[model samples]
Target: MEMQGEERIAARRDIVWAALNDPEILRQCIPGCQSLELKSPTELSASVKIKIGPVSASFSGDVVLSNINAPESYTISGEGKGGIAGFAKGGADVILTEDGDDTILAYEAKAEIGGKLAQLGSRLVGSSAKKLAQQFFADFNAAVSAQAAANS
Candidate 1:
């Protein structure tokens, strides 16, 4: 599956970049995220629970950020196991550009699933993924906006 989208954050590029890389902020933005640990500058371990269609599962995964361009763009990838439910792996290329007083965050993502998750059919899985992505960005935008407000 493939997905791409963008959001305008009411914050500067640097602030947005910093927030995006922060585990605390990510944990708040990620839907059903139980924990997020930053193992290194570019590595993270996480546990998240999700319900897609009729299947509900908790997934533990490792995320790695590549092609670091400090405050500009990077590629993030990870894979998760959902016990008997299935497994999922995905990667996203994210870019940030300054737009007036805001930052425009753009991303292109691709994902693949196996086992029971794959059996759920592409339409259902894809729809769930899209909703999840939307929810993440909405939360992210709100968090960044609030942070920016607090700093001002």
Candidate 2:
């Protein structure tokens, strides 16, 4: 599946960029995230629990950041294993552009599922993925905006 969207965050570009790279911020923002540990500047290990339709699973994975252009854009990718449930892998290309005192964050993402997850039907899986993405961005925006307000 593929998805793309943009969000206008009420924060400076630099602040938004920093938050994007912060594992703590990501762990807090990502839906169902249990833990996120930075293994390197460009790598992270994460565990997330999610429910799709009637399936519930905990996924453990390593996220990698590549094609990086600091404070501008990067490609983030990861794959997770969920034991009997299945596996999920995806990547997103994120771009941040300055919009006055705020920042415009845009992303294009693509994902694939195998095993039982793929058996759930595309319509259901796609809707769930879209909802999850939206929730993540909304939470991320709120966290960044709050932090910016606190600092200023």
Candidate 3:
């Protein structure tokens, strides 16, 4: 499925980018995120718990950031295993645009699933994926906004 959204964060692009790259901040912002570890400047490992339809699973995987453009845009890709639930692989292009007094954080992502997850049908998987993405963005925006407020 494809997912996209934009969030207005009350912070400079540099500040926002720093937060985005910070694993600790991401762990807190990611919904159902059990853990997030940065292995390199542009690579990370994570585990997240998710409930899709009637199936509940925990997925762990490695994510790599590529095609970097400083304080602007990048492509992120990852492949994760969900035990009997299935496997998932996806990539997203994140773009940051300058907005008055804030930054417009936009992303478009494509995700693919296999194994039991693929057996669950597209509609159910798609809806759940969309919800998860939205939740992550919402949490991220709130966290960043709060951090900015506190720092100001």
Q: Which candidate is the best by TM-score?
A: 2
Backbone collisions counted per model: 0, 0, 0
Q: For this target, which candidate reaches the highest lDDT against the unseen true structure? A: 2
lDDT of 3 by residue, 1-152 (tens): 89998989998888889888899999998888999999999999999998888888899999999999988999989999999999999988999998876999999999999989898899999999999888888899888888988988
Runs of candidate 1 with Cα error greater than 4 angstroms are none
Tell me the tens digit of each residue's lDDT in model 1 across 27-145: 99999999999999999999999999999999999999999999899999999999998899999999999999899999999999998988999999999999999899989999998
Q: Which candidate, 2 or 3, would have the higher TM-score against the true structure? A: 2
Give the lowest summed-lDDT range of ten residues in model 1.
111-120
Model 1 lDDT at residue 59 = 96
Cα distance off (Å), candidate 1, residue 88: 0.4
Question: What TM-score goes with each of the models?
Answer: 0.98, 0.99, 0.97
* Model 2 misplaced stretches (Cα beyond 4 Å): none
User: What are the per-model C-alpha RMSD values against the true structure?
Assistant: 0.6, 0.4, 0.9
Q: Write the per-residue lDDT of candidate 2 for residues 40-95, one digit (tens) a residue.
A: 99999999999999999999999999999999999999999999999999999999
Off by over 4 Å in 3: none
Model 3 global lDDT (CA atoms, 0 to 1): 0.91
